[model samples]
Target: MATLLELREEPHWSYSALNTYLNMCSLKFAFQYVYKAESERTAASLPFGRAFHIAATHHAQSVMQGKRMTLPELHDVFAQWFKLECAACTNLTFKNGESINSLTEQARFMLDALLARWIDWNNIVSVAHAFKVQVPGLGKPLVGEYDMVIKDGETTSIVDWKTSAARWSEGKAGRDFQATAFSFAYLLEEDHGMIPLFRFDVVTKTKNPSLENHYTQRTKDDLYRFQLLALAVERAVKQEVFLPAETSFCCGDCQFASACKEWHRSSAAKHICMAA
Candidate 1:
Protein backbone atom coordinates (compact mmCIF):
# COMPACT_ATOMS: atom_id res chain seq x y z
CA MET A 1 0.00 0.00 0.00
CA ALA A 2 1.81 3.07 -1.25
CA THR A 3 0.87 6.54 -0.01
CA LEU A 4 -0.28 8.99 -2.68
CA LEU A 5 2.87 11.06 -2.09
CA GLU A 6 5.04 8.01 -2.66
CA LEU A 7 3.04 6.93 -5.69
CA ARG A 8 3.43 10.46 -7.14
CA GLU A 9 7.22 10.13 -7.05
CA GLU A 10 7.05 8.74 -10.60
CA PRO A 11 4.81 9.12 -13.63
CA HIS A 12 1.29 7.73 -13.19
CA TRP A 13 -2.28 8.22 -14.34
CA SER A 14 -5.33 9.29 -12.36
CA TYR A 15 -8.99 9.54 -13.25
CA SER A 16 -8.60 13.28 -13.86
CA ALA A 17 -5.77 12.79 -16.34
CA LEU A 18 -7.68 10.08 -18.18
CA ASN A 19 -10.88 12.15 -18.26
CA THR A 20 -9.00 15.18 -19.58
CA TYR A 21 -7.53 13.14 -22.39
CA LEU A 22 -10.55 11.04 -23.38
CA ASN A 23 -13.47 13.38 -22.63
CA MET A 24 -12.16 16.95 -22.42
CA CYS A 25 -9.39 17.61 -24.97
CA SER A 26 -6.19 15.80 -25.82
CA LEU A 27 -4.35 19.00 -26.76
CA LYS A 28 -5.13 20.53 -23.38
CA PHE A 29 -3.85 17.38 -21.70
CA ALA A 30 -0.57 17.53 -23.63
CA PHE A 31 -0.13 21.22 -22.80
CA GLN A 32 -0.65 20.67 -19.11
CA TYR A 33 0.87 17.27 -18.43
CA VAL A 34 3.34 16.53 -21.26
CA TYR A 35 4.75 20.02 -21.93
CA LYS A 36 4.24 21.25 -18.36
CA ALA A 37 2.79 24.56 -19.52
CA GLU A 38 1.70 27.05 -16.90
CA SER A 39 -1.93 28.02 -16.73
CA GLU A 40 -2.65 31.66 -17.58
CA ARG A 41 -5.83 31.78 -15.52
CA THR A 42 -7.60 29.68 -12.90
CA ALA A 43 -11.29 28.82 -12.90
CA ALA A 44 -13.23 30.14 -9.92
CA SER A 45 -14.87 26.75 -9.47
CA LEU A 46 -11.49 25.10 -8.80
CA PRO A 47 -10.85 27.04 -5.62
CA PHE A 48 -14.50 27.01 -4.59
CA GLY A 49 -14.61 23.23 -4.88
CA ARG A 50 -11.28 22.87 -3.08
CA ALA A 51 -12.44 25.04 -0.18
CA PHE A 52 -15.71 23.14 0.00
CA HIS A 53 -13.87 19.80 0.03
CA ILE A 54 -11.60 21.00 2.82
CA ALA A 55 -14.63 21.76 4.95
CA ALA A 56 -16.25 18.46 3.97
CA THR A 57 -13.12 16.53 4.94
CA HIS A 58 -13.04 18.27 8.30
CA HIS A 59 -16.69 17.48 8.94
CA ALA A 60 -16.34 13.83 7.92
CA GLN A 61 -13.24 13.30 10.04
CA SER A 62 -14.83 14.97 13.07
CA VAL A 63 -17.92 12.78 12.80
CA MET A 64 -15.81 9.61 12.53
CA GLN A 65 -14.07 10.63 15.74
CA GLY A 66 -17.39 10.53 17.62
CA LYS A 67 -18.27 14.21 17.31
CA ARG A 68 -20.03 16.24 14.63
CA MET A 69 -19.23 19.87 13.94
CA THR A 70 -21.96 22.42 14.50
CA LEU A 71 -23.13 24.55 11.60
CA PRO A 72 -21.27 27.62 12.88
CA GLU A 73 -18.11 25.61 13.35
CA LEU A 74 -18.37 24.19 9.85
CA HIS A 75 -18.94 27.69 8.48
CA ASP A 76 -15.76 28.86 10.21
CA VAL A 77 -13.81 26.00 8.65
CA PHE A 78 -15.13 26.88 5.17
CA ALA A 79 -14.35 30.57 5.74
CA GLN A 80 -10.71 29.81 6.48
CA TRP A 81 -10.42 27.56 3.44
CA PHE A 82 -12.18 30.16 1.24
CA LYS A 83 -9.76 32.85 2.36
CA LEU A 84 -6.78 30.62 1.70
CA GLU A 85 -7.94 29.31 -1.68
CA CYS A 86 -9.88 32.24 -3.20
CA ALA A 87 -9.17 35.55 -1.46
CA ALA A 88 -5.43 35.55 -2.13
CA CYS A 89 -5.48 34.25 -5.70
CA THR A 90 -5.28 36.96 -8.37
CA ASN A 91 -5.81 34.77 -11.47
CA LEU A 92 -9.22 33.39 -10.52
CA THR A 93 -11.97 34.13 -13.06
CA PHE A 94 -15.50 34.56 -11.77
CA LYS A 95 -18.62 33.96 -13.82
CA ASN A 96 -21.18 36.62 -14.60
CA GLY A 97 -22.51 38.39 -11.47
CA GLU A 98 -20.20 36.30 -9.31
CA SER A 99 -17.89 37.78 -6.69
CA ILE A 100 -15.85 36.52 -3.78
CA ASN A 101 -18.58 37.38 -1.29
CA SER A 102 -21.32 35.79 -3.38
CA LEU A 103 -19.36 32.56 -3.88
CA THR A 104 -18.62 32.41 -0.19
CA GLU A 105 -22.33 32.80 0.55
CA GLN A 106 -23.09 30.06 -1.94
CA ALA A 107 -20.61 27.79 -0.21
CA ARG A 108 -22.25 28.50 3.13
CA PHE A 109 -25.67 27.62 1.76
CA MET A 110 -24.28 24.51 0.07
CA LEU A 111 -22.65 23.32 3.26
CA ASP A 112 -25.85 23.94 5.19
CA ALA A 113 -27.73 21.85 2.68
CA LEU A 114 -25.13 19.11 2.96
CA LEU A 115 -25.64 19.03 6.73
CA ALA A 116 -29.37 18.75 6.24
CA ARG A 117 -28.95 15.54 4.23
CA TRP A 118 -28.82 12.09 5.77
CA ILE A 119 -25.22 10.82 5.94
CA ASP A 120 -24.66 7.37 7.30
CA TRP A 121 -21.20 7.08 8.79
CA ASN A 122 -21.56 3.62 10.18
CA ASN A 123 -18.11 2.04 10.74
CA ILE A 124 -15.92 4.56 9.03
CA VAL A 125 -13.05 2.62 7.48
CA SER A 126 -10.87 5.39 6.07
CA VAL A 127 -10.98 9.08 5.15
CA ALA A 128 -8.83 10.43 2.33
CA HIS A 129 -7.58 6.96 1.53
CA ALA A 130 -4.89 6.73 -1.13
CA PHE A 131 -4.78 3.82 -3.57
CA LYS A 132 -2.57 2.65 -6.42
CA VAL A 133 -3.27 -0.22 -8.83
CA GLN A 134 -1.43 -1.73 -11.77
CA VAL A 135 -3.76 -2.53 -14.60
CA PRO A 136 -2.95 -5.48 -16.88
CA GLY A 137 -2.18 -3.52 -20.07
CA LEU A 138 -0.94 -0.12 -18.81
CA GLY A 139 2.70 0.62 -18.10
CA LYS A 140 2.32 3.06 -15.19
CA PRO A 141 0.15 2.47 -12.16
CA LEU A 142 -3.14 4.32 -11.58
CA VAL A 143 -3.32 6.39 -8.44
CA GLY A 144 -6.18 8.26 -6.74
CA GLU A 145 -7.62 9.23 -3.37
CA TYR A 146 -10.93 8.00 -2.02
CA ASP A 147 -12.83 10.67 -0.06
CA MET A 148 -14.51 8.24 2.29
CA VAL A 149 -14.66 4.43 2.68
CA ILE A 150 -17.26 2.89 4.89
CA LYS A 151 -18.54 -0.59 5.76
CA ASP A 152 -22.30 -1.02 5.92
CA GLY A 153 -23.37 -4.54 6.81
CA GLU A 154 -22.09 -6.77 4.01
CA THR A 155 -21.24 -3.94 1.63
CA THR A 156 -18.29 -1.56 1.35
CA SER A 157 -18.75 1.86 -0.22
CA ILE A 158 -16.37 4.39 -1.73
CA VAL A 159 -17.82 7.90 -1.49
CA ASP A 160 -16.73 11.00 -3.35
CA TRP A 161 -17.91 14.60 -2.93
CA LYS A 162 -18.73 16.90 -5.82
CA THR A 163 -20.06 20.45 -6.29
CA SER A 164 -22.22 20.90 -9.38
CA ALA A 165 -24.01 23.90 -10.92
CA ALA A 166 -27.05 21.76 -11.72
CA ARG A 167 -28.56 18.43 -10.71
CA TRP A 168 -26.96 15.43 -12.37
CA SER A 169 -28.97 13.17 -14.64
CA GLU A 170 -29.90 9.82 -13.14
CA GLY A 171 -27.59 7.79 -15.36
CA LYS A 172 -24.61 10.13 -15.16
CA ALA A 173 -23.06 8.17 -12.32
CA GLY A 174 -23.49 4.80 -14.01
CA ARG A 175 -21.70 6.01 -17.10
CA ASP A 176 -18.96 7.91 -15.25
CA PHE A 177 -15.47 6.60 -16.06
CA GLN A 178 -14.18 7.79 -12.72
CA ALA A 179 -16.57 5.42 -10.98
CA THR A 180 -15.29 2.50 -13.03
CA ALA A 181 -11.69 3.40 -12.24
CA PHE A 182 -12.46 3.77 -8.54
CA SER A 183 -14.35 0.50 -8.40
CA PHE A 184 -11.48 -1.19 -10.17
CA ALA A 185 -8.95 0.18 -7.70
CA TYR A 186 -10.98 -0.77 -4.66
CA LEU A 187 -11.60 -4.26 -5.95
CA LEU A 188 -7.90 -4.89 -6.50
CA GLU A 189 -6.65 -3.16 -3.35
CA GLU A 190 -9.29 -4.12 -0.80
CA ASP A 191 -10.03 -7.50 -2.36
CA HIS A 192 -13.48 -7.48 -0.76
CA GLY A 193 -14.60 -10.23 -3.22
CA MET A 194 -17.68 -8.13 -3.95
CA ILE A 195 -18.05 -5.08 -6.16
CA PRO A 196 -18.12 -2.03 -3.92
CA LEU A 197 -20.65 0.74 -4.38
CA PHE A 198 -19.32 4.04 -5.72
CA ARG A 199 -21.32 7.03 -4.60
CA PHE A 200 -21.14 10.68 -5.60
CA ASP A 201 -22.54 12.96 -2.95
CA VAL A 202 -23.15 16.08 -4.99
CA VAL A 203 -23.97 19.53 -3.62
CA THR A 204 -25.55 21.99 -6.03
CA LYS A 205 -24.91 25.73 -6.13
CA THR A 206 -28.43 27.14 -6.31
CA LYS A 207 -30.25 29.91 -4.51
CA ASN A 208 -31.38 27.20 -2.14
CA PRO A 209 -28.73 24.50 -2.34
CA SER A 210 -29.57 20.83 -2.68
CA LEU A 211 -27.71 17.59 -1.96
CA GLU A 212 -28.13 14.57 -4.19
CA ASN A 213 -26.72 11.12 -3.70
CA HIS A 214 -25.91 9.20 -6.85
CA TYR A 215 -24.89 5.57 -6.39
CA THR A 216 -23.21 3.55 -9.13
CA GLN A 217 -21.44 0.22 -9.37
CA ARG A 218 -19.13 -1.43 -11.83
CA THR A 219 -18.54 -4.98 -13.09
CA LYS A 220 -15.66 -7.00 -14.43
CA ASP A 221 -16.50 -5.81 -17.95
CA ASP A 222 -16.35 -2.18 -16.85
CA LEU A 223 -12.93 -2.69 -15.30
CA TYR A 224 -11.78 -4.40 -18.49
CA ARG A 225 -12.90 -1.39 -20.51
CA PHE A 226 -11.14 0.93 -18.07
CA GLN A 227 -7.86 -0.89 -18.61
CA LEU A 228 -8.32 -0.77 -22.38
CA LEU A 229 -8.93 2.98 -22.20
CA ALA A 230 -5.78 3.48 -20.17
CA LEU A 231 -3.82 1.45 -22.66
CA ALA A 232 -5.19 3.53 -25.54
CA VAL A 233 -4.35 6.77 -23.73
CA GLU A 234 -0.78 5.56 -23.23
CA ARG A 235 -0.46 4.68 -26.91
CA ALA A 236 -1.83 8.08 -27.97
CA VAL A 237 0.64 9.86 -25.73
CA LYS A 238 3.49 7.81 -27.11
CA GLN A 239 2.47 8.63 -30.67
CA GLU A 240 1.88 12.35 -29.85
CA VAL A 241 -1.60 12.32 -31.36
CA PHE A 242 -2.89 15.29 -29.41
CA LEU A 243 -5.64 17.33 -31.07
CA PRO A 244 -7.51 20.40 -29.87
CA ALA A 245 -11.26 20.14 -29.32
CA GLU A 246 -12.65 23.41 -30.67
CA THR A 247 -16.17 23.06 -29.32
CA SER A 248 -15.28 21.84 -25.82
CA PHE A 249 -17.30 23.34 -23.03
CA CYS A 250 -14.05 24.09 -21.12
CA CYS A 251 -12.78 26.52 -23.79
CA GLY A 252 -14.22 29.63 -22.13
CA ASP A 253 -11.80 29.68 -19.19
CA CYS A 254 -9.02 27.44 -20.50
CA GLN A 255 -5.65 28.36 -19.07
CA PHE A 256 -3.77 27.38 -22.22
CA ALA A 257 -6.00 29.28 -24.63
CA SER A 258 -3.02 31.21 -25.98
CA ALA A 259 -0.99 28.06 -26.41
CA CYS A 260 -3.92 26.34 -28.09
CA LYS A 261 -4.22 29.25 -30.48
CA GLU A 262 -0.52 29.04 -31.33
CA TRP A 263 -0.90 25.30 -31.88
CA HIS A 264 -3.54 25.93 -34.54
CA ARG A 265 -1.36 28.44 -36.43
CA SER A 266 0.86 25.64 -37.78
CA SER A 267 -0.11 22.22 -39.12
CA ALA A 268 -0.82 19.55 -36.48
CA ALA A 269 2.20 17.53 -37.61
CA LYS A 270 4.49 20.56 -37.38
CA HIS A 271 3.40 21.41 -33.84
CA ILE A 272 3.44 17.78 -32.72
CA CYS A 273 7.04 17.39 -33.86
CA MET A 274 8.14 20.58 -32.08
CA ALA A 275 6.53 21.47 -28.76
CA ALA A 276 4.30 24.59 -28.98
Candidate 2:
Protein backbone atom coordinates (compact mmCIF):
# COMPACT_ATOMS: atom_id res chain seq x y z
CA MET A 1 0.00 0.00 0.00
CA ALA A 2 2.71 2.47 -0.99
CA THR A 3 1.51 5.96 -1.84
CA LEU A 4 2.72 7.69 -4.98
CA LEU A 5 4.83 10.09 -2.92
CA GLU A 6 6.41 7.22 -1.02
CA LEU A 7 7.13 5.39 -4.25
CA ARG A 8 8.86 8.45 -5.65
CA GLU A 9 11.02 8.75 -2.53
CA GLU A 10 11.80 5.02 -2.41
CA PRO A 11 14.61 3.53 -4.44
CA HIS A 12 13.07 1.35 -7.17
CA TRP A 13 14.31 -0.02 -10.46
CA SER A 14 12.43 0.35 -13.75
CA TYR A 15 13.30 -0.43 -17.33
CA SER A 16 13.72 3.22 -18.34
CA ALA A 17 15.62 4.04 -15.12
CA LEU A 18 17.96 1.07 -15.59
CA ASN A 19 18.47 2.00 -19.26
CA THR A 20 19.32 5.52 -18.13
CA TYR A 21 21.91 4.11 -15.73
CA LEU A 22 23.41 1.98 -18.49
CA ASN A 23 23.46 4.93 -20.89
CA MET A 24 25.16 7.30 -18.41
CA CYS A 25 25.69 6.22 -14.83
CA SER A 26 26.78 9.62 -13.54
CA LEU A 27 23.76 11.36 -15.07
CA LYS A 28 21.33 8.71 -13.77
CA PHE A 29 22.83 8.73 -10.26
CA ALA A 30 22.75 12.54 -10.01
CA PHE A 31 19.22 12.81 -11.36
CA GLN A 32 17.68 9.85 -9.51
CA TYR A 33 19.46 9.73 -6.11
CA VAL A 34 21.50 12.93 -5.70
CA TYR A 35 20.62 16.62 -5.85
CA LYS A 36 19.06 17.27 -9.26
CA ALA A 37 20.57 20.52 -10.54
CA GLU A 38 18.86 20.68 -13.94
CA SER A 39 15.17 21.20 -14.50
CA GLU A 40 13.40 18.24 -16.10
CA ARG A 41 12.96 19.04 -19.79
CA THR A 42 10.17 17.61 -21.91
CA ALA A 43 11.06 16.29 -25.33
CA ALA A 44 9.31 17.68 -28.39
CA SER A 45 7.36 14.46 -28.99
CA LEU A 46 6.36 13.92 -25.36
CA PRO A 47 3.18 15.99 -25.47
CA PHE A 48 1.76 13.96 -28.30
CA GLY A 49 2.84 10.71 -26.69
CA ARG A 50 1.33 11.67 -23.37
CA ALA A 51 -1.88 12.74 -25.03
CA PHE A 52 -2.07 9.47 -26.97
CA HIS A 53 -1.53 7.37 -23.84
CA ILE A 54 -4.08 9.39 -21.85
CA ALA A 55 -6.66 9.05 -24.57
CA ALA A 56 -5.95 5.37 -25.08
CA THR A 57 -6.02 4.64 -21.35
CA HIS A 58 -9.28 6.54 -20.96
CA HIS A 59 -10.84 4.60 -23.78
CA ALA A 60 -9.60 1.28 -22.44
CA GLN A 61 -10.81 2.00 -18.92
CA SER A 62 -14.20 3.06 -20.19
CA VAL A 63 -14.53 -0.13 -22.21
CA MET A 64 -13.42 -2.24 -19.28
CA GLN A 65 -16.08 -0.57 -17.14
CA GLY A 66 -18.70 -1.43 -19.78
CA LYS A 67 -18.98 2.11 -21.12
CA ARG A 68 -17.23 2.24 -24.46
CA MET A 69 -16.78 5.63 -26.08
CA THR A 70 -17.41 6.55 -29.70
CA LEU A 71 -14.52 7.33 -32.01
CA PRO A 72 -15.41 11.04 -32.22
CA GLU A 73 -15.66 11.31 -28.46
CA LEU A 74 -12.28 9.65 -28.08
CA HIS A 75 -10.83 12.06 -30.65
CA ASP A 76 -12.16 15.02 -28.67
CA VAL A 77 -10.69 13.59 -25.49
CA PHE A 78 -7.31 13.25 -27.13
CA ALA A 79 -7.52 16.81 -28.49
CA GLN A 80 -8.26 18.22 -25.07
CA TRP A 81 -5.40 16.32 -23.47
CA PHE A 82 -3.00 17.41 -26.23
CA LYS A 83 -4.02 21.06 -25.80
CA LEU A 84 -3.44 20.98 -22.06
CA GLU A 85 -0.14 19.16 -22.41
CA CYS A 86 1.11 21.71 -24.96
CA ALA A 87 0.11 24.64 -22.73
CA ALA A 88 1.83 23.14 -19.70
CA CYS A 89 5.11 22.40 -21.47
CA THR A 90 6.93 25.67 -22.10
CA ASN A 91 10.17 24.22 -23.48
CA LEU A 92 8.65 21.96 -26.17
CA THR A 93 10.03 22.78 -29.60
CA PHE A 94 10.04 21.03 -32.95
CA LYS A 95 13.05 20.97 -35.26
CA ASN A 96 10.86 20.84 -38.35
CA GLY A 97 9.09 24.16 -37.68
CA GLU A 98 5.98 22.40 -36.46
CA SER A 99 3.79 24.48 -34.15
CA ILE A 100 1.55 23.22 -31.37
CA ASN A 101 -1.52 23.54 -33.54
CA SER A 102 0.14 21.55 -36.30
CA LEU A 103 1.25 18.88 -33.83
CA THR A 104 -2.25 18.66 -32.42
CA GLU A 105 -3.66 18.16 -35.89
CA GLN A 106 -1.08 15.43 -36.55
CA ALA A 107 -1.97 13.80 -33.25
CA ARG A 108 -5.61 13.81 -34.24
CA PHE A 109 -4.73 12.03 -37.43
CA MET A 110 -2.68 9.53 -35.49
CA LEU A 111 -5.48 9.01 -33.01
CA ASP A 112 -7.97 8.35 -35.77
CA ALA A 113 -5.68 5.76 -37.29
CA LEU A 114 -5.00 4.17 -33.93
CA LEU A 115 -8.69 3.89 -33.09
CA ALA A 116 -9.45 2.38 -36.44
CA ARG A 117 -6.91 -0.37 -35.92
CA TRP A 118 -7.58 -0.93 -32.22
CA ILE A 119 -11.01 -2.52 -32.53
CA ASP A 120 -10.32 -5.24 -30.00
CA TRP A 121 -10.91 -3.25 -26.83
CA ASN A 122 -13.47 -5.81 -25.69
CA ASN A 123 -10.64 -8.24 -24.98
CA ILE A 124 -8.89 -5.99 -22.47
CA VAL A 125 -8.76 -7.42 -18.94
CA SER A 126 -7.10 -4.41 -17.35
CA VAL A 127 -6.24 -0.85 -18.28
CA ALA A 128 -3.50 1.22 -16.66
CA HIS A 129 -2.93 -1.70 -14.32
CA ALA A 130 -0.42 -1.02 -11.54
CA PHE A 131 1.76 -3.82 -10.27
CA LYS A 132 4.67 -4.17 -7.85
CA VAL A 133 6.67 -7.37 -7.85
CA GLN A 134 9.80 -8.44 -6.00
CA VAL A 135 12.26 -9.45 -8.68
CA PRO A 136 14.58 -12.29 -7.72
CA GLY A 137 18.09 -11.11 -6.75
CA LEU A 138 16.98 -7.44 -6.55
CA GLY A 139 16.61 -5.58 -3.29
CA LYS A 140 13.79 -3.20 -4.19
CA PRO A 141 10.46 -4.08 -5.74
CA LEU A 142 9.98 -3.40 -9.44
CA VAL A 143 6.95 -1.24 -10.02
CA GLY A 144 5.25 -0.60 -13.36
CA GLU A 145 1.99 0.73 -14.72
CA TYR A 146 1.08 -1.32 -17.73
CA ASP A 147 -0.98 0.15 -20.55
CA MET A 148 -3.32 -2.79 -21.16
CA VAL A 149 -3.57 -6.47 -20.37
CA ILE A 150 -5.86 -8.66 -22.50
CA LYS A 151 -6.82 -12.11 -21.30
CA ASP A 152 -8.25 -14.74 -23.61
CA GLY A 153 -9.21 -17.82 -21.60
CA GLU A 154 -5.86 -19.29 -20.63
CA THR A 155 -3.69 -17.04 -22.82
CA THR A 156 -2.72 -13.44 -21.97
CA SER A 157 -1.58 -10.52 -24.07
CA ILE A 158 0.18 -7.36 -22.92
CA VAL A 159 -0.38 -4.25 -25.02
CA ASP A 160 1.91 -1.20 -24.93
CA TRP A 161 1.13 2.01 -26.81
CA LYS A 162 3.79 3.93 -28.71
CA THR A 163 3.50 7.27 -30.48
CA SER A 164 6.43 7.77 -32.80
CA ALA A 165 7.30 9.03 -36.28
CA ALA A 166 8.75 5.69 -37.32
CA ARG A 167 7.26 2.22 -37.11
CA TRP A 168 8.97 -0.19 -34.75
CA SER A 169 10.56 -3.42 -35.94
CA GLU A 170 9.96 -6.84 -34.44
CA GLY A 171 13.64 -7.05 -33.57
CA LYS A 172 13.36 -3.89 -31.50
CA ALA A 173 10.33 -5.32 -29.73
CA GLY A 174 12.21 -8.51 -28.98
CA ARG A 175 15.12 -6.56 -27.49
CA ASP A 176 12.96 -4.05 -25.56
CA PHE A 177 13.72 -4.13 -21.84
CA GLN A 178 10.32 -2.72 -20.93
CA ALA A 179 8.54 -5.55 -22.75
CA THR A 180 10.80 -8.14 -21.12
CA ALA A 181 10.26 -6.69 -17.67
CA PHE A 182 6.50 -6.46 -18.12
CA SER A 183 6.34 -10.08 -19.21
CA PHE A 184 8.39 -11.12 -16.20
CA ALA A 185 6.18 -9.15 -13.84
CA TYR A 186 3.02 -10.62 -15.34
CA LEU A 187 4.37 -14.15 -15.04
CA LEU A 188 5.32 -13.53 -11.44
CA GLU A 189 1.81 -12.30 -10.68
CA GLU A 190 -0.06 -15.11 -12.48
CA ASP A 191 2.43 -17.96 -11.97
CA HIS A 192 0.69 -19.62 -14.91
CA GLY A 193 3.63 -20.82 -16.99
CA MET A 194 1.97 -19.14 -19.93
CA ILE A 195 4.19 -17.02 -22.17
CA PRO A 196 2.23 -13.85 -22.73
CA LEU A 197 2.25 -12.19 -26.13
CA PHE A 198 3.72 -8.67 -26.03
CA ARG A 199 2.22 -6.27 -28.52
CA PHE A 200 3.45 -2.77 -29.32
CA ASP A 201 0.79 -0.65 -30.95
CA VAL A 202 2.74 2.19 -32.56
CA VAL A 203 0.97 5.25 -33.94
CA THR A 204 3.15 7.21 -36.32
CA LYS A 205 3.24 11.03 -36.28
CA THR A 206 3.46 11.69 -40.00
CA LYS A 207 1.30 13.88 -42.26
CA ASN A 208 -0.75 10.77 -42.89
CA PRO A 209 -0.60 8.86 -39.64
CA SER A 210 -0.19 5.09 -39.67
CA LEU A 211 -0.57 2.29 -37.14
CA GLU A 212 1.89 -0.57 -36.77
CA ASN A 213 1.58 -3.57 -34.51
CA HIS A 214 4.76 -5.34 -33.47
CA TYR A 215 4.59 -8.61 -31.55
CA THR A 216 7.18 -10.37 -29.37
CA GLN A 217 7.14 -13.33 -27.02
CA ARG A 218 9.61 -13.27 -24.20
CA THR A 219 11.53 -16.50 -23.60
CA LYS A 220 13.09 -17.74 -20.37
CA ASP A 221 16.44 -16.51 -21.65
CA ASP A 222 15.10 -12.98 -22.03
CA LEU A 223 13.80 -13.02 -18.47
CA TYR A 224 17.11 -14.35 -17.23
CA ARG A 225 18.92 -11.53 -19.03
CA PHE A 226 16.65 -8.95 -17.39
CA GLN A 227 17.27 -10.51 -13.96
CA LEU A 228 21.03 -10.38 -14.55
CA LEU A 229 20.75 -6.74 -15.61
CA ALA A 230 18.78 -5.88 -12.47
CA LEU A 231 21.33 -7.65 -10.27
CA ALA A 232 24.22 -5.80 -11.94
CA VAL A 233 22.48 -2.44 -11.46
CA GLU A 234 21.87 -3.20 -7.80
CA ARG A 235 25.52 -4.17 -7.28
CA ALA A 236 26.68 -0.99 -9.00
CA VAL A 237 24.48 1.14 -6.74
CA LYS A 238 25.74 -0.64 -3.59
CA GLN A 239 29.38 -0.23 -4.69
CA GLU A 240 28.87 3.48 -5.58
CA VAL A 241 30.21 2.89 -9.10
CA PHE A 242 28.43 5.71 -10.86
CA LEU A 243 31.11 6.47 -13.43
CA PRO A 244 30.34 8.50 -16.53
CA ALA A 245 29.78 6.24 -19.51
CA GLU A 246 31.53 6.90 -22.82
CA THR A 247 30.22 9.85 -24.79
CA SER A 248 27.63 9.05 -27.42
CA PHE A 249 24.82 10.75 -29.35
CA CYS A 250 22.81 10.73 -26.12
CA CYS A 251 25.29 13.23 -24.63
CA GLY A 252 23.71 15.96 -26.77
CA ASP A 253 20.52 15.83 -24.68
CA CYS A 254 22.10 14.94 -21.32
CA GLN A 255 21.16 17.33 -18.51
CA PHE A 256 24.31 16.53 -16.47
CA ALA A 257 26.77 17.23 -19.29
CA SER A 258 27.93 20.53 -17.81
CA ALA A 259 28.48 19.01 -14.35
CA CYS A 260 30.28 16.01 -15.82
CA LYS A 261 32.56 18.24 -17.90
CA GLU A 262 33.35 20.45 -14.89
CA TRP A 263 34.21 17.42 -12.76
CA HIS A 264 36.52 16.08 -15.47
CA ARG A 265 38.34 19.43 -15.73
CA SER A 266 38.80 19.61 -11.94
CA SER A 267 40.17 16.05 -11.84
CA ALA A 268 42.56 16.78 -14.71
CA ALA A 269 43.77 19.97 -12.96
CA LYS A 270 44.37 18.09 -9.72
CA HIS A 271 46.42 15.42 -11.54
CA ILE A 272 48.49 18.12 -13.34
CA CYS A 273 49.23 19.92 -10.06
CA MET A 274 50.29 16.67 -8.38
CA ALA A 275 52.60 15.75 -11.32
CA ALA A 276 54.15 19.23 -11.43
Best by TM-score: 1
The residue pairs found clashing in candidate 2 are none
User: Candidate 2 has what TM-score?
Assistant: 0.85
lDDT of 2 by residue, 85-136 (tens): 8778745566567876777677667878877787665688877777777899
The C-alpha stretches of model 2 lying farther than 4 A from their native spots are: 1-9, 23-29, 66-68, 87-90, 190-193, 266-276
The residue-by-residue lDDT of candidate 1 on 168-234, one tens digit each, is 9989999998899989888877556566999999999888889999999998998888888889999
TM-score of 1: 0.93
For all candidates in order, the CA lDDT equals 0.86, 0.75
Task: State the displacement of the C-alpha of residue 104, model 2, in Å, after optimal TM-score superposition.
Answer: 1.0
TM-score of each: 0.93, 0.85
Clashing pairs in 1: none
